[model samples]
Target: MSLGKSRLWGVVARGMAMGAADVVPGVSGGTIAFITGIYQELLDSISRVGPHALTVLRRHGPLVAWQYINGSFLLSLFTGILISVVSLARLIGYLLDTYPVVVWGFFFGLVLASVIPILRRVPRWNTGAVIYLILGVLVAIGVSELRPAQVPATPLTLFLSGGLAICAMILPGISGSFILLMIGIYPHVLTAVHELQLVKLLSFAAGAVTGLMLFSRLLSWLMHHYVARTLAFLGGILLGSLKIIWPWKLPSDEVAAMGDKMAPLMSNTSPWTFAEVTGESSYLLAAGAAALMAVLIVLAVDFWGHRRGAHH
Candidate 1:
């Protein structure tokens, strides 16, 4: 519960990584949390932030309640998330726009490499665990295949979108931004962030808080009782999500007609096919390098985390 200065900064850095991942539609901040070894702690902290914390506040004091809920960790993590989200939103958008293959390649490699560490954490793989893992993969692929729906961007819709998206955002394979995009609110949310639309952002934040409070408890319980199965399922999700972030994509005719270059319809292809179909260079070498770099980064982080855990 105590966050020393060095540890606080470490948590902040992890949060920033999560935030950056969440900005991209196919990447989950939760994936970053898992790879960085904070997934369980993050869930437990969020799950503790309600009635008990209130009771503790009234009976003990603000400080006791804060400690009970791991307030410092949450604060440090969220501060990093906010900072990264605000600063990287535009930049990430630009990169995805201008260099789609390279950007997607990097995240693709990140999620792919992340699956190894996650699956390793599963102590044993039973029949039920395998089934759950397969189910997770199927569900993620199904979600990825969904086309964006048309929805009005009213406050109510934004609130609902936030609630749904936040749940996905915390899951290792599911992406909150992808959820928003599916609901047809991604552009609205991104525009609000970019333009600093306070009212809209606050509405979204309120929904996210409510959803996080409710979902975290259930996820935490599942994780506790079904550790191996839960991890397997999440690992499956990461595997399933690889299809969504594939570097070579052929834009859907509808998306091209809409003039929305960035919001592709998740049509995948090989680099050769992409180049042949679009007559644009697939940038295969560059994309491959990016993916390779991401894989190395994830492996390094995983190794470092294990070493640190051993020390602890």
Candidate 2:
């Protein structure tokens, strides 16, 4: 295939993967983008909608700003993500509700397998990289351990939460919706979006646009100047995030009643060891492992192909 065709296919594959990830709560599309080696490009593309874009908008109008933005790239990538999210949301939600262990286990494997591709990209390992990795891991572990907070479920709050959550959504190891959950906004924002609350939805969209544009620039700058270290840190974040994504559990006793609607609240208590070992559900773990292995194999093939192309 021509280089352009090859790149096009690669982007399409990435979009699909990203969409799949976005459908999962703890997993992140950013992780898929990072693992697939298009993270920097995505960040750069987002960052391009910057001050200059605002200036163009002010001078010429929204059309000018749209022209300045990489609309094609954004449209293609986001369309894929949107399709995946919308199509899979109900299915993923059902799986998480009905077969929580299996779904989470699968994600655990996927994230674990992702580490290999991420770490392999670092041409050199050093003290700084090691420290960054450790730091990232620690942060993830800490974040995972944090108890979810309680906050108001209001339109403005949902808007802000949407913005912040989407920003984290784009980071390789961070889960945007998870962040919303932490802030007690996940349910509210999701409800607003689902209910077709136009005001809330538009507000949330504005916030997401602002957050994506701003955060992308910062990310792009870091990737440009501190490429290796940033990736190392990101790898650590991914490692840390696994705790949250890990499938398997003991039931939580804590239940919060939200206006007669009872919701199970996860506690700090650890899962049962027995459940992890001997259970009919043990098959799920094996399946998860297989899925992870498949991801690794696909990544390896892509890497090999890219290397061969470079050599030729």
Candidate 3:
């Protein structure tokens, strides 16, 4: 599929959205890709960047190899992602710090609405699909329930963390940022982005590339073979993760005792109960509006994608 200039820019815009989603702890960029109707293409493109592409280059030429792997699409998409992560890092960090509920409200709505498209991808429903969905929910909830662990800030650990987190990042409903949070390097990674720490950033990027290459093939194969069950499972993961992104939260007793280091492990609470528990305004109306806006935005994107597909 050749992308004209406008379509190329459209892919970039989608990448920006994905990057923004990735910055948040409870939102996955993979979900954004799925919603924007590019998830499969993205996986296929990445999966091609191995020995097959090298062979193509040897037999044909660099240009043919690049075209075979949809190099322009990957380049344009990642360019947008890089621009967004670099530009929005500080801004998103500030928003999360100052307006936690509103920020989380947007992400929660995004993830919530995203589940529709994901589930819709399932070709058919059956007992196997139902079982996979349930299993996915259980796995997501189990991962969410884990406490944060401390790790050294060494390069090796950062590389490993990057690999692990990137795997989660590309999986629908699983947030790479949240994985970093669980691994106790969320702040450091954010700081590295914000501060332009080249060494740290490069280490993380190396790991991310390694992980992306390794995982994309497996994902593509699963998507090709067991698309229905896989999508069912992914949709269930999105549903199960709603607990983590709930706008109103209170620090668990243990989390409170652990101080700032463990603040991300908060327990979800109702908006009404939030004020009483935290002695702060719940901002329920604001949060609700933000969530509604997010949902509307996703719906608009979905509508546009479908229209484009129909035209094609």
> What ranges in model 3 sit over 4 Å off?
153-156, 187-203, 256-264
Relative to the unseen true structure, what is the C-alpha lDDT of residue 224 in candidate 3, on a scale of 0 to 100? 98
Question: What lDDT score belongs to each candidate, Candidate 1 first?
Answer: 0.90, 0.74, 0.87
The number of the candidate with the highest lDDT is 1
Ranking by lDDT: 1, 3, 2
- The TM-scores, one per candidate, come to 0.93, 0.83, 0.91
lDDT of 1 by residue, 67-116 (tens): 99999999999999999999998999999999999999899889999999
Task: List CA RMSD, all candidates.
Answer: 2.3, 3.8, 2.5
What does candidate 2's lDDT look like per residue over 231-312, in tens digits?
7888899999987876655447665433336677553323356355435344455656656775676478558756865897
Q: What does the lDDT come to for candidate 2? A: 0.74
Best by TM-score: 1
Candidate 1 similarity to native, TM-score: 0.93
Worst 10-residue lDDT window, candidate 1: 255-264
Candidate 2: list runs displaced more than 4 Å: 1-6, 54-68, 256-260, 266-280, 294-298, 301-305, 308-312
